[model samples]
Target: MSQTLQAIYAAKRKARRFAVQGIYEWQMSHNPVHEIEARTRADNAMHKTDLGYYHELLSEVISNADVLDALLVPVLDREISALDGVELATLRLGAYELKEHAEIPYRVVLDEAIELAKHFGGADSHKYINGVLDRLAQSLRAAEKQQAK
Candidate 1:
């Protein structure tokens, strides 16, 4: 990957981490994204460079979340709404890439989510996340092909 792309992914990983924390907060209080964004920003416990990336990513994902979740439901036979906070948000982040940021190869997006799932989500969550993302990537590619024709 180019340095810029690597920087972007670094931003995305940070975003994923922030997204996890924000999602957890949303679940707890059902707060709006704007409020959560402000809160996450208000603290910034450290003067860290990495936190900025995560903060921006979390903001984007949270802001676009309704549309993102809409894309997820059809792929899942069960109501994904009932999924754990981390799993649901992780899927949203991957879906955001698949649906909105098609510039990134679908496989790479899925890979990022799988890596996150393995590290952060529960046992077997990686497998579950992988399955959903694989299907999502295929759909995204198919849609792109159709749009091209």
Candidate 2:
């Protein structure tokens, strides 16, 4: 990736860290997602990692969460209701890139998210994540084609 895109990926790495932290906190507490979200953004220091891209990406993903979840369903074969909160969050972040951020190559986004899943999610989470992202990317291409026609 060029310098500009590299910065964005670095940001995504940062965002992933924050997202994981925020999601973990949400899991541990009854505190609303918004409260957790606000806290994450409020303390830029929480990112800890050098990547500002993470800050931007996490903020955008959380900001546009509804649409991101919509894209997530088709990619997920199992009922989305079955997914735990962390799995749900991972899928949404990966889906957000596949559907909305067309600028980032789909493969790169999926790979990064899978890495996050492997590190932070359940042991099997990466498999589930990869499967969903692959399906989501294919559907996104189909949607683009239909729109073009």
lDDT: which candidate is best?
1
Runs in model 2 deviating more than 4 A are 1-8, 23-34, 41-56, 142-149
User: All candidates' TM-scores?
Assistant: 0.75, 0.70
The per-prediction CA RMSD against the true structure, in angstroms, equals: 3.8, 4.5
lDDT of 2 by residue, 14-118 (tens): 767677666546445746666776776677774445445554455666667678777776667778778877777778777766776787677777888788888
lDDT of 1 by residue, 1-149 (tens): 89987776676666666667786677667898778877877876533336665665566677777887787877875787688777887898888778867786777788888888887899999888988887776677786646555
Task: Judge candidate 2 against the unseen true structure and give its global Cα lDDT, from 0 to 1.
Answer: 0.71
TM-score of 2: 0.70
